[model samples]
Target: MQFATEILTSFLAIIVPFVGVFLERGCGIDLLINVILCCFGYIPGIIHALYIILKY
Candidate 1:
């Protein structure tokens, strides 16, 4: 179950880092930050999501 959840989060991160970060750590300022990064650039968003998933 953990593996599946991680996989899902990774996929979500690639597509929408905002949702991925929110799912990983629940809704908060981080989610808003990620959304802003995503708007600025895709790479930043994906990197932030991966960092979030790996960090927590």
Candidate 2:
């Protein structure tokens, strides 16, 4: 379980910058959405990052 969380944290950390790029490219998503996701839960941030990567 701890390993899983570490993997998730690493994944999200890597994805944050890519998310910024997508947001900058005007993918039609708001930065606040990712910020909110981060605040709410790790899973949301992960999901949001994956979505950004796949979508943009």
Candidate 3:
């Protein structure tokens, strides 16, 4: 069950970047950073999202 949720979040992270982080952490600094990263480039946002998702 946890694995499935992680997988889904990972998919969302890759597809939409900060959205997964937003779902996981809600409105906060991480989400803000991710949004900024996304504004700069898609890859950074995806990377940050995956890191945050996997780490916490």
Identify the leading candidate in terms of TM-score. 3
* Per-residue lDDT of candidate 3, residues 1-56 (tens digit): 99999999999999998889998999999999999999999999999999999998
> What is each predicted model's overall lDDT from 0 to 1?
0.91, 0.58, 0.96
* Superior candidate under lDDT, 1 versus 2: 1
Instruction: Report per-prediction Cα RMSD to one decimal.
Output: 0.9, 8.3, 0.5
> For model 1, how does the per-residue alpha-carbon lDDT over 1-56 read when each residue is reduced to its tens digit?
99999999999899888889999989887888899999999999999999999898
Ranked candidates (lDDT, high to low): 3, 1, 2
TM-score for all predictions?
0.88, 0.48, 0.97
lDDT comparison, 2 vs 3, better candidate:
3
| Cα lDDT, model 1, residue 17 | 83
List, residue by residue over 1-56, the lDDT tens digit for candidate 2. Answer: 95565456456446674354244444545556766777788667667666664454
Clashing pairs in 1: none
Return the TM-score for candidate 3, rounded to 2 decimals: 0.97
